[model samples]
Target: MSVTAVIRKNSYFDSVSLMSISTKANGIDGVDQAFVAMATEMNKAVLENLGLLSDELKAATTSDLMIVVVPSEGADGDELVPLVEELLVRKAPAAGSAEVSHRTIASALEEDADINLAVIAVNGAFAAREARKALDAGLNVMMFSDNVAVEDEIALKNLAHDNGLLMMGPDCGTAILNGVALCFGNAVRPGTVGIVAASGTGSQEVSVQVHALGGGVSQLIGTGGRDLSAEVGGVMMIDGIRALAADPGTEVIVLVSKPPAAETEAKVLAEVANAGKPVVVYFIGGSRDAVLAAGGHFAASSADAARQAVELSSAAASAPETLDAGQVDAVLARLTPEQVNVRGLFCGGTLCDESMYALLNDGHEVFSNIQKNPAFQIGAADSSRGHTFLDFGDDEFTNGRPHPMIDPSNRLARIVEEAKDPSVAALVMDFVLGFGAHEDPAGVTLPAIREAQRIAQEDGRHLEIIAYVLGTELDTPGLDAQRKALAGAGVTVTSSSTVTGEFARAIARKGAAA
Candidate 1:
């Protein structure tokens, strides 16, 4: 194998675009692995871990763009640099077309006075400054950049609250405004239900579920993951609630989060009581009684939250989707008595939490990196015990690498690693399709899935892989095609995240009995 590094001095590209370039480069015929990213400290550390860091890479400044490739035998790694450069070339507008690209927020607003919202995706160190400029310009802000100081977030949110404008996030990853999906969201249909969520995947799962149930969303607002923490105090959640309540198009509201701080929860619930519309609350492991007392409906899961919101808006209940009992039995029949553990390698953090909760509620002991109870936490993230569900998008896994959704390499590697264990029987995962996510999530992960199964089969064991594709028909990659591909691979594809968890739980339970 040959390793090559290409460094461009003082070049900068957003992480998302770099991740896309990296994925494309890895798809090259002879490339074993590729890294296309800015030479930041975190990224350099990632290169070191992979043993791909050359002296040139180490000497490159953070401002420099780095493209490193490890090519297979007989593959010329140097020949691939031109192809990477071609992908980096930004496409210009068609001849005679009147498209304009502005370099600054002020320039954009000047070009179009109707622009009311500013989407900021920059380094966290400068994200606050950029957000402040937007808020000062009388525009709503959705900051996709994480790592901004908590104090800066508080100040910016307060400024927006005083101005009666929306401040969506410091690390907000999903939202739908006026029926338009923005930054890591599904193409959901518009209707009477509105959502204010502090969790990204939780919002996608709920909104997609609503669409599947003959209901649609009026709006899906994101209040970055930390909005409900004691420090942030649910400022944006309260703002989102008021906005949705006042929206004539929104008749039923849904709130998604992983349990807010006590005082923060009270503040948010107080707003819910005054929403004057039906509100469905799902807080992972929150109290149902508190929601009931607040005149809100408590949801048991993300899917349940969607169902309640849809039923409230449409006044019609759809029959619940059921797990295929015969299929479950067939999968169980193939499993050996010694192979009794379920390992979930997920790209979506909220989906991981929801699945863990499902297994725990089913009287199964679940260990996870995100588990709050110390008893259920794993000593080492690299190994699994009993039923384990991991959120690969967590900070530990993503500090230097892109999210697993953006780049499935880490999760794909973990799948093969877990399959090597003789005790593993089933694998659960999620394929999140939408804007700003992987272009072909299911298609890209298929090879790894097949490889993992092959290893188990060669060892006289059967591995069952269950997955849920969280998307809609209108998504860019299209949900049907992704599902079809996975099903064709002999993998069990469930209808929803909750159902995926339930299905895995059943398989694990059956394995335990055997």
Candidate 2:
């Protein structure tokens, strides 16, 4: 599809629109275009990077940098500073302002209208209704909403498709265009690993793992949570694959989703048949018998997706073995039954899921939410209940990114807060590595660790610390030093999954002693 996107720097109204199908515009007047902002200076507080004319434009020469992204005449473009109320993904096929700061959606909606949009977008559900109105105005709807229902997503996607437009999502999280993330997404890794998934956390974890394995990514696309639902038709997932196949940079594709109904799976399999690139499909809990007719590979786990992605990036028929047994041993020992109770507090959903599964397998009764008599968050007093793996990323807390890998403060705070819980004994974290990631998660985590340790010591809790890092400082040089810094501070590290499992088992065995 030929895309024409425009970014206005001077206008106070900013928006993204998609122009689909042929349209008749007698003239600028007939087009019903209007930009009416009489403000002396409008504010732009963007949550995601939707691109200002240039990077220099991203900086605010005025006011507070606390604002996400703002509009100022500064050194950007000559067009009016577009008012983006809530910066979100821009797949407009047409352009509109986002991130309006405190401006009302109605005011933000009053943007230049010469070009018709096939879809209008806001970052997530906060803008769903407003986005729909723009869609009614012939915009091809692509929204960043994460909580949209399965049926709503299907209808919107279908309506857009019927009009020859594409609808992005109800819970769609991230999208990369020309290698830059237009949402709250990490920077592109830039390799042959192209991913299309029904899960945001799963996809993010896969991408992080791929990067850790010395592989980059061609593109990563999200198909929302219910894309494969029987009601939704799974069109986005299908189209995402087609788009990846078309991108020359992508040599291999990865598809991840929870199991769909049998029929939906069949349809997805049928669609996979035509793609020329080798694919690795992971349908969580999918049967081994399920196969992709086309030359596609199926993997049993997300980590396997990481392994396959590395294999695809290298031309060698054989995969590179970057395993370091030393690091592995360190991590495994921490999880050993003799360590301490290992509790996990994570921001990312997938990390929580993986940690829960791993800890459970290690023989710990993982309490996710404290409300269900789970050990972590039910009561202010209950948080102290030790021998728990708590995921702070559940809907109750996280405001934006679920994975603490992106924003460490909130998750770290949860970790420290949990450390104060008298019943707790140990803590575990995943040091996710990649671009747009905290320079050193362990570094960021160390202060919290020390505080937790200090509090534990004061309380006579004697908390043990262990971490499961996705990357090795050894492979990344200074990164190894960073890992060592944490180790030096008393946090043991494990190099790979095998070691993490061992450490967790140790924690369980140790917890039984407590």
Instruction: State which candidate has the highest TM-score.
Output: 1
Q: 367, model 2: CA deviation in Å?
A: 2.7
Best of the candidates, lDDT? 1
Per-residue CA lDDT of candidate 1, range 341-390, in tens?
99998999999998888878878888898888888876424588888999
After aligning candidate 1 to the native by TM-score, how far in Å is the CA of 8 from where it should be?
Answer: 2.5
Please identify model 2 stretches exceeding 4 Å from their true place.
Answer: 1-126, 129-142, 163-166, 229-233, 258-266, 291-295, 313-340, 360-365, 370-387, 399-409, 420-425, 431-444, 457-462, 468-488, 493-514
Instruction: Give lDDT tens digits, candidate 2, residues 1-514.
Output: 1111233343332212210000111012222221211111121222222232233333433222211222232423112112221232334443566633334434444654543432234333335665556566666444654555565677666666566554667655555544655443454356778888876667766765676677777788777767887888688888888888888988888887756667777777777678887878887656556664444677756777778767866633334333455654554443333344567665455555555555555556666652233333352224534455555545445332223444465566667786776555567666655443455667767888888889877865456676765543323324467668778988866554334445555556556764
Candidate 1 least-lDDT 10 residues: 314-323
- What TM-score does each of the candidates earn? 0.94, 0.62
Model 2 alpha-carbon miss at residue 306, Å: 2.0
